[model samples]
Target: MTKTIPNYLRIHRGIDRQDSTNREQSQNLITSFWNSYSDATGWRIDSRASRKNNVLELLPAVTSETPQDHSDEFTPVVGRIAATRLATAASNLTEQVLRTRECLRQREAELASSAAMIGVEHDGKVSADQIEQSLADAMEACKCDAAALYMLDEDTRYLKARSVVGLPIERLENPPRELRGSRGDLEAMVQDVVTIDNMTAGSIDTWNSPEPFAAGICVAIKVDDIPIGTLWLFRETTTEFGSTESAIARLVATNLSLLLRQAPQAEIFDNPQPHQAIQEIAQWQYESLPVGSALAEGWRVDGMIESSESWATGWHHWDVLPDGTLMLAIAEATDPTATGAMHAAVARAALAAHSGYRHTPAQLIQRVSDTLWQTNTGEQLVSMTYAHLDPETGDGIVSSAGSISALISSRYGYRPLISSLSAPLNTSMDSNAANHEFHMLEGETLLAYSKGFATAGADQMTLGGHIRTAMQLEDRSPLAMLRRKLIDLPLTQERGALTLLRT
Candidate 1:
């Protein structure tokens, strides 16, 4: 053997040496990469990203509570005012802006006056007598023959009369909390205002106040995006609710809501300017109801959010484009105060303003980042999940910023998903960040949420377990499921938002 080594034996020895060299080199390279990468960026890209990520997109796991739409158009018309519609010229733009500004100023003044008239800003407490007097005052303030204030029952669905003024004697004697039976045409939770000149011909039974009522205006009163009650101004005459009239009624209704949300009947009886008043103002200022009419059919979205800070903003929104693309998004502010909420709202307004140039979530996030930076509001970071899901295929293109992720369930169990950590909508981050697309099989649903949910969540595992069961059920509802998981937490306040999307 020593005299003559065979060629096969010689080749095997060489291959073993080569394999050893390659292993040593690979180990050295990985070590150097980790050290250099962490030192340079202050973070490490997960090794798992190589396995889960495609070239550009990601799939997250989340839905609704419906978010308020942030459209710039405001009109103080018969029902509502378009907020800001740009004009052709800087001069014309200046004039139009002035016009809009004046309208809002007048509108706000009217609201403040009407709310103040209801004894909202009084130094003393609120009473049944005070509320009844306010209803009477509101009717007179709006120059209507009658007014009724229906507060949301604990169920937060049916509006029962908390106070009533100027109704038929019979209705006043036996006031029905429910204005009408089961509603399909209009979701009371989503609608802001309604005006009917003629009750019978309006085609909505809910709007028909009652017999002997010829016209009426109805307004929803909400706090922190949750509807608490409704204010209705009924007129025996056939006159319509003009723009001024509608705006006045809405202002009165809005402040009335603030009064209720701030002064529990007890607090109202105790103090006029409750500490919660400022927070309520901030929350309601930019936060509004989503334009449900713009959503596509067969899709329902719901969201639940709690803010620890008065300025903290949690929002959910969805809209349909000209070409049938459905976009849904939920956002949370990092600062957890009104300033943070304002940042989130500004980000949303920027997104809506440039919607013409953005179709996908990627483009939208990128544009939003740019807008924030350009507007100098990029200091406060906002975490968000924006996605487009095709109802036909149940496949979705999801773009995320910060700690947004998705979940999908298989027979084995629930799996958390995301390729890697992406930059939040910040001036410091790269605008060319990638988006991920998730293709789902039958029975798999997606959940999207702010990372804060993880921090606020009392039982993270229980939340997942509930969501898993919901996914497996034939008649699953994301709203009911999310409410169950997040409701009645040990913590008095939470700063997180959640949204769900289904096939």
Candidate 2:
């Protein structure tokens, strides 16, 4: 019998192959173009120049005194204009390249951070024994008679039992539960945790188990905020699950999710290729922050991303909607791996693509969450703040998920803008986000940032104080002042921030 490849494994292989091919083609094209250009110009290119400064050094500097009518030279005026234009273009390109490199470095740091957090070795394999042991521990900790782990199928249409204890595995596998409707498993996934007072009650969907159980509790298994499966525990008595049991169940489920994510990847590759994984992740391009700033009649928006020497995943985006409303968003991923960056990218793209639809801040956030769920990449959690402001009136609405921070700063002082936050995107199937309305008067600024902005052990007040001090410097732009104030802080993690000043 031929061994069949799983759908997910095939998909990963195809993606990896395509990425490799694209990189090779890009390098070849660059080499060919440079060779042809050098031949045409009769300029011997410096092969030893550093990557950082090579682009500028490759172009010959134009001089004002060059002859205008010469077949090979330009007039003084023409030469000056060409030189100025070339300089400007080179400067912009160089800046963009530097920014891209910095972003890549930050993402690498995030991947390392994620690896440490998940406590998984670079070998990629997560053994079945480890998963079984986790389930046994959960059962012992929760004091449940039996437990079952149902993982989502490849298509995410059904939940299939992957591990079982104190129950017949064949019984649970007879018919996998479809992931639709208000079934116990689905409810647990949506609500995070569900408790059944009695298994015989209508609230529990037992699927007619052979062994009768009195009570049960189910907790959603999630990586990042995306639900991947459900963990069920059964009891012989109708004892309600308390906070301790619920917590232990959730913890076990969390560990299982991480292991599950790795198991498939390991099985598909069948080899220890840690370097390849890191390279592929590093080369995976995410959406870059919007270039420069945006300006309206009364509003000026400037954004900055300061990558940490440590782990950081942050992005900020701003665009002018068709109706002249300025849309702004800032997000941070909990895990600093490719999955986390992709989560931020998905949110950013959804926000930009749907801005023309005129969705409110809360609605926009819901759309991003929905996009993330649909993609099914649940390896990381993304916290975001979405806002839209009427430039003419400085009236705006802001909504946040997770704990992303938003503040308003003026001559009075800086204070928090988003008082409450909902669960992060992919955390739940439904949106619990709420929009907060605020008005910005002249000389007031609105600043939104990811957790990366705060150094470890620092409180909100300390972050606020830094912003207030940055605001006091009237001679510089808000973004510039903020960057200068906080860039030197000892950051063990990454930070991203966006600022809008009403002048």
Largest TM-score belongs to which candidate? 2
Per residue, candidate 2 scores C-alpha lDDT tens digits across 1-503 of 99988644522111112333332222443345445544444332345666464353444323333344662652232243454445446457657865764454334323322332243444333454566678788888888877777767656797666666666434343567677753677778788987775665555436333235666778888767777677788766666567888788778877776666665465557753446754554344333456555467767787766553222366777888888888888887777655566666677677777777757888888888888788874544678888888888888998888878788887668788974655777788766776789999887888787666555544566656665676566533776766665555766666677888887
Would you estimate the TM-scores of all the predictions?
0.42, 0.43
lDDT of each: 0.56, 0.65
Best by lDDT: 2
CA shift of 224, model 2, Å: 49
Model 1, backbone clash pairs (residues 3+ apart or across chains), number: 39
State in Å the error of residue 33, model 2: 74
Clashing pairs in 2: 68-75, 225-426, 452-494, 452-495
Q: For candidate 1, lDDT tens digit of each residue in 414-486?
A: 6665536566678475555557877656555456656655655543455556666776664346546666766
Segments in model 1 whose C-alpha atoms lie over 4 Å from true places: 1-287, 291-297, 409-412, 427-429, 432-434, 457-461
